[model samples]
Target: MDINMNEMIKDCLFFGMVISIFAYGFGKKLKDKWKLPIFNPLLIAILTVIAVLLALGIEYESYYASAKYLSYFLTPATVCLAIPLYQKLSLLKKNIKAILLGIFSGAMTSMGSVFLLSYLFQLSHEQYVTLLPKSITTAIAMGVSEEMGGIVTITVAVILVTGILGNMTAEITCKVFKITDPVAKGVAIGCASHSIGTTKAMEMGEVEGAMGSLAIVVAGLCTVVFISIFAQFM
Candidate 1:
């Protein structure tokens, strides 16, 4: 197999863009079909990208080469979440205790669950740490995984799956529990699910959307602190 690093990088970017578009198209179809709870665009995009990459027998390194530049945006995109939080400052101040506790608990549970489950399976050390930040936002989770000497790529997959599960279940959980308050609703989804859950909350209405946006930043921050505490204790 002839492998050119430059060519591989270019291919990653090209395929990543193409798959992302396909996922967007699929999401529109899903929305039209009324599969509201399960049809998250990020989930669609991740699945589509994986399928295409596998089918084409392409190496991820090649694609990353071309796509690495785009990865830089992850940081700024995370920072942009501040806009939504700022828009709802009063709302945050009103429920600061619940928001902080709930997010911190959810974040801890997410990581702790992955850790316990993977350990029981006797996975390799690399696999264990790679899955550590599975519940947090992707950019931060991946960075943490790398710093912890884990596989960033695997951690990305964990984040995607965790986000999808959170997005898919938030509505059902809320409904079963008869949760009507937008603040509670948003916090539940955002803390448990992250961005995908936030997207689902957006479809709910302004109140829920605002709350969910707050969830994203709060949960992200809480997750960071939770991980730090865990590291210190360990």
Candidate 2:
């Protein structure tokens, strides 16, 4: 009977959903209690699920087979960021120049820094391309990676780690540098880390959240264009 149950769980269609929900719920609980960006619910949920899968000796393919459905909504979720941007239209309008400058500079820095490091480290062409769009959202980054002949899985992993680090360190870094401007905070986080970092911006304040949201959109577009052109030369 126990063996049969284990087999049934393995083949269960809803098992992935169950795991995702459980992991997210547990993560949310920890975030509520700890109130630290390092305890970000998404990060916690991902780590928890990975640990569970490894402990259960389950293959990633088996889990992803059932979990891929959740990924279908990523595009829509990315689009939904416009809500906050719309709400902060006046502020956006007022600081259009600053916002654009910050976004453009940050986007370029992300690409340039990666290129320089990849070259300095003597990384292969594939590795360089895969890490190029690490600062963008996964949906756009994966597309860029595919076009650049990079490994999609490696791109995704790099994006996640970049976002987690950005979210975890943005505040402390800001304080150390005495960056108290709301727009600056938002733009810095959004451009450097994309959506994951925007979560921390949102927690900081409405202005920061709005700017961060706007930064994600602008930076994504900029990265797509720049990476495409850069890849042409590669």
Candidate 3:
């Protein structure tokens, strides 16, 4: 019976895609109805998918086999972010120095905080490296984790949590910190949260979206270089 079920799931090539879309759509509906940050569509969708998979005894590998196709669009989607950035090119160029400095500072702060916590907690070297790239996008973070001999799976999980937290708290944090500058808001969100957080940044405004998109690229590059140097210490 189990073998038959597994085979049935495996043979249904669209199963994962269908489930993912339906889950996200349901999540969106809930968010629209609630208009609450806690009703975050992505978070709800993730939880819903996990629940369904567990309830059905579906292996993640089978689900990923079909769902992986969706990831093919990730790069293009990221590139599409440049559209807003292009619109705000004048603003970006004018504040290029400040923007670069902000992103660099944010990246350093993220890594430094992780290092300090890891030291305080006495986490293993592998664990420390796994978390070092937690604030960047999945693609870059995974590569950095692997290069630094960290657990890529853990790094991905950390990245997701980091992004979600950033997404959920960005506006509140800005208000509390009195960060009124749109560019600063964007840079902070993108640098700390990567692509997932950028979604929230986009909703904030076009200028915020543009700066957040720019931050993703610049911070990712900075992390790549910084991680390489930092690994020498480990």
Candidate 4:
């Protein structure tokens, strides 16, 4: 009976589902109770799942084998960003030049800063490659990382850390920098932080949300192009 039970748990179909659901639910509760950006549900869920896996001595491969199903919705999730963009279509058209410029600047700055820091720190080539697309969404970043001979796992981790940090600090950073324009704030957030930062942008206002939504798509494309070009030199 013990052997049978151990085998059942090892192959448990619901293990992944249970872990994700529980982590998110717990994270939501903490966020609601604390009202802190650091308690962002995604970050909290990741931590909780990691802690559980460590305590149980579960290998990451086993968990990911089942949990990879969650990635199926990533593309659709990005498409959902278009909803807010459509709502602000007129404003976007009117200010297309400025918005495009802001997104381009932000995307370049994000990748450039990472590269500069990597050089200064003398990071390994693998580390540099993994971090090049940290600001882009995970789906696109993973592809770019693969093309650049980066470790996809490290890219995903860096993306998550970048998103959480950007989401937590963007408001304060904007205030200190005196960035009063909603469009600028939205573009900065989405270009540097992706979906997680867009959550904060949505809370700021409809206009910001719309701008951030647009920035996510543009930044993703720009990162892909940048990586493709850079890969030639590598």
Q: Which candidate tops TM-score?
A: 4
Best by lDDT: 3
In the range 1-234, model 1's lDDT, one tens digit per residue, is 877544554645466556567777987788678876556666676677667666767666665665566677888887786776788899878778877777777778877877678778977767777877776678677777787778888788777877778777777899999988888888778777677777878877777777777777777777666665454322
Model 3 TM-score is: 0.84
Off-target runs (Cα >4 Å) in candidate 1 are: 1-39, 177-180, 231-234
Clashing pairs in 1: 8-62, 9-62, 9-65, 9-66, 12-63
Local accuracy of candidate 4 as per-residue lDDT tens digits, 150-207: 8998898888888878888989999999999998998889898898888899999987
Stretches > 4 Å off in candidate 2? 1-10, 176-178, 232-234
Q: Tell me the spans in candidate 3 whose CA falls farther than 4 Å from its real position.
A: 1-3, 72-88
Of 1 and 4, the candidate ahead on TM-score is: 4
Clashes of 3: 0
Native-to-model Cα distance after best TM-score fit, residue 119 in candidate 1, in Å: 3.8
TM-score of every candidate: 0.79, 0.86, 0.84, 0.87
Please report, in order, the local distance difference test score of every candidate based on alpha carbons: 0.73, 0.84, 0.84, 0.81
Write candidate 3's Cα lDDT for 1-234 as tens digits.
336555578778788889999999999999899976567677788789889988888888888878877777766776675575576667778888999899999989988888888889988889899889989888778767988999987787778888878989999999999999998999999999998888899999998998888888789879998887765555
Rank order by lDDT, top first? Answer: 3, 2, 4, 1
Instruction: Return the clash pairs for model 2, or none.
Output: none
User: Which pairs of residues have clashing backbones in candidate 3?
Assistant: none
lDDT by residue for model 2 (1-234), tens: 245434555677877778998999999999999987677777789889989888877777678767777886877876786675676677778888988988899998888888878878988888889998999888788878988899998898888888879998999989998989999999999889888888989989988887887888788889998997655434
Against the true structure, candidate 2 reaches a TM-score of 0.86
Residue 152 miss distance in model 1 (angstroms): 1.8
